[model samples]
Target: MKNLIILLLFLFVGQQNIYAQKTIKIWVVRHAEKDVSNPKDKDPDLSPLGKERAEALAKYLKGEKIDSIFSTNYKRTRLTGYPTADKTGLTIQTYDPATHSELAKNLIKNAEGKRMLIIGHSNTVQEILVAFGAQKPVKELTEDDYDYIFELTIKGDKREVKVDRYGAEHHTKE
Candidate 1:
């Protein structure tokens, strides 16, 4: 009878520890399409279609409990994350694309058990995945590809990554 009580106590404590280590969900995406009409402006903002796509992205993640939003110091990236940040009532936090490894470490530390959204460029999306210790290498997104959504789930020492599509259907030419 005493052994049975001790076993139950051990089981309860183990379950509590398991519950304490919650899984972290990180959503990654490239910035929306930019307007290249102005040649002089080095940092152009999102185009009309880009704005619409941003709105769709916000709607897609509206139900999610996004704890933080990260974007580069670029206009396009900031605009892409603005809608979601506004919806979640969280301000956009800027991160340097040059220091992706450090950013990944900080994200893992601060965003544990929380949902985070990151807006980056096509060139940097793959690097972010690699920084998070993703098993598979993500291909560089094409210039016209703005619908890719990379979902990363981190639970303890295990990490899983899945690619999804969001916003309007992008018609790629063969």
Candidate 2:
């Protein structure tokens, strides 16, 4: 019931911004689950469920008209966004994970009034969200967390965020 309300709110807002020239809409998501086969591997690809989650992400944003897609330079993050890029005919651009503030500034300045999708890591998403003007406290993403879609709408200095879910419901691994 909570997700349904959030989804409805997101859809309503999404509709309102489709043709607006002064609003910027950004959907920030953590990369889907990665392969844990090689636990020591610094970089890894998406696991089978991750791939399915990727597809679900794409399908969820099918008509959102994303103007750009951004991802960290890791296989897991790249693949998490690949399905959406492929479906939308947009290429995934890489950003330096360490420069979260810079990336937020660049996007606000250059990509104004456009919709974007950012696929980031658990540790990076919160920082990026803050840089884009999220004033309230946001929880850190845990290893077991992977289903949040941080919907952001920016107009000049004002930014509104809505946390919604996409793909299958993820339960925290206790």
Candidate 3:
């Protein structure tokens, strides 16, 4: 019995080390609120509230060694990545929405062995999530909703992603 217990403890410690080494995390967030000052209706930069939220997000990600930053070819998404990128010294790569799938595929290919943060709009986030092989589909996420954060972990052929609602609880999807 003593030998058996020792063997099991050794195996548990070894497994923990392997799991720590192989784990990778990705954080996906919607761009912060936008300015509506331009009554003429053109895309504007982040509003004051948006700037505050962006700063909050930067603080939230301070310690993580973010490898790459990816965003859509839009001002909002670029602005969202700015504070974090400034802190981490990671350059932001712009992906065109017209070729969303292609951009997503290339991102996953290039991000192998590295952690990435992707900022996108409400409409585009779900599409990219699907491209990443995420099984659950968010049917209705609006611009006012800046709540859901998608956390994804990929190792070899296996993929796991969970949705974390900002005001609520995190749930793992099937």
Candidate 4:
């Protein structure tokens, strides 16, 4: 009986490892809404509504097992990640905007089957999407836009891109 129990335990562990290797979910959020009204606000921070949105975003993501989080060197992106990181206990990685596409590629390579979140700007996010070969001209996402989650599913040599846009929305290029 003991031998049978040990075999069962081993099988459970093996199944878990297999699942870990099969799938990864990635959440890409445009930085929260910024205070663009202030001409003096050279470096715009999250506006009041933006802060609330961040809190809502945190609540929505609280239960997910997010393995990694990333943000631009900018304060807005870093701040946008704060709530999620605090909830998930993951530190946000800062990457340069100029080299963002390369950095994103490296991230996908290293992430393997683990989930990751990358927070970025309107322009930089476009480059990131291009790097993933998900789409071209990746559509400059803005603070006013809480677009959708870019879900990439990888199995062996096959990769698929699906967008789970907010409010079940979809985008078509002009």
TM-score of each: 0.89, 0.84, 0.77, 0.73
Give the Cα error of residue 106 in candidate 3, in Å: 1.8
C-alpha displacement of 109 in model 1, angstroms? 2.3
Superposed model 1: Cα runs more than 4 Å off = 2-20
Q: What is the C-alpha lDDT of each candidate?
A: 0.87, 0.89, 0.75, 0.70
Off by over 4 Å in 4: 1-21, 136-143, 165-174
Q: Alpha carbon lDDT of residue 10, candidate 1?
A: 100
lDDT tens per residue, model 2, 112-138: 779999999888887888988875336
Clashing pairs in 4: none
* 2 against 3, candidate with superior lDDT: 2
| Model 3 spans > 4 angstroms off | 1-24, 165-174
Order of models, best lDDT first: 2, 1, 3, 4
| Residue 87, model 3, lDDT | 94
lDDT of 1 by residue, 1-174 (tens): 999999999999999997887888988899988999998998999999999999988998988899989999999999999999888899999999999889999877777789989898888897888898886445457777788888999987888999888888765624
Query: Highest lDDT among the candidates is held by which one?
Result: 2
- Model 1, residue 93: C-alpha shift (Å): 0.3
Number of the candidate with higher TM-score, 1 or 3? 1
Candidates arranged by TM-score, highest first: 1, 2, 3, 4
lDDT of 2: 0.89
Which clashing pairs does model 1 show?
none
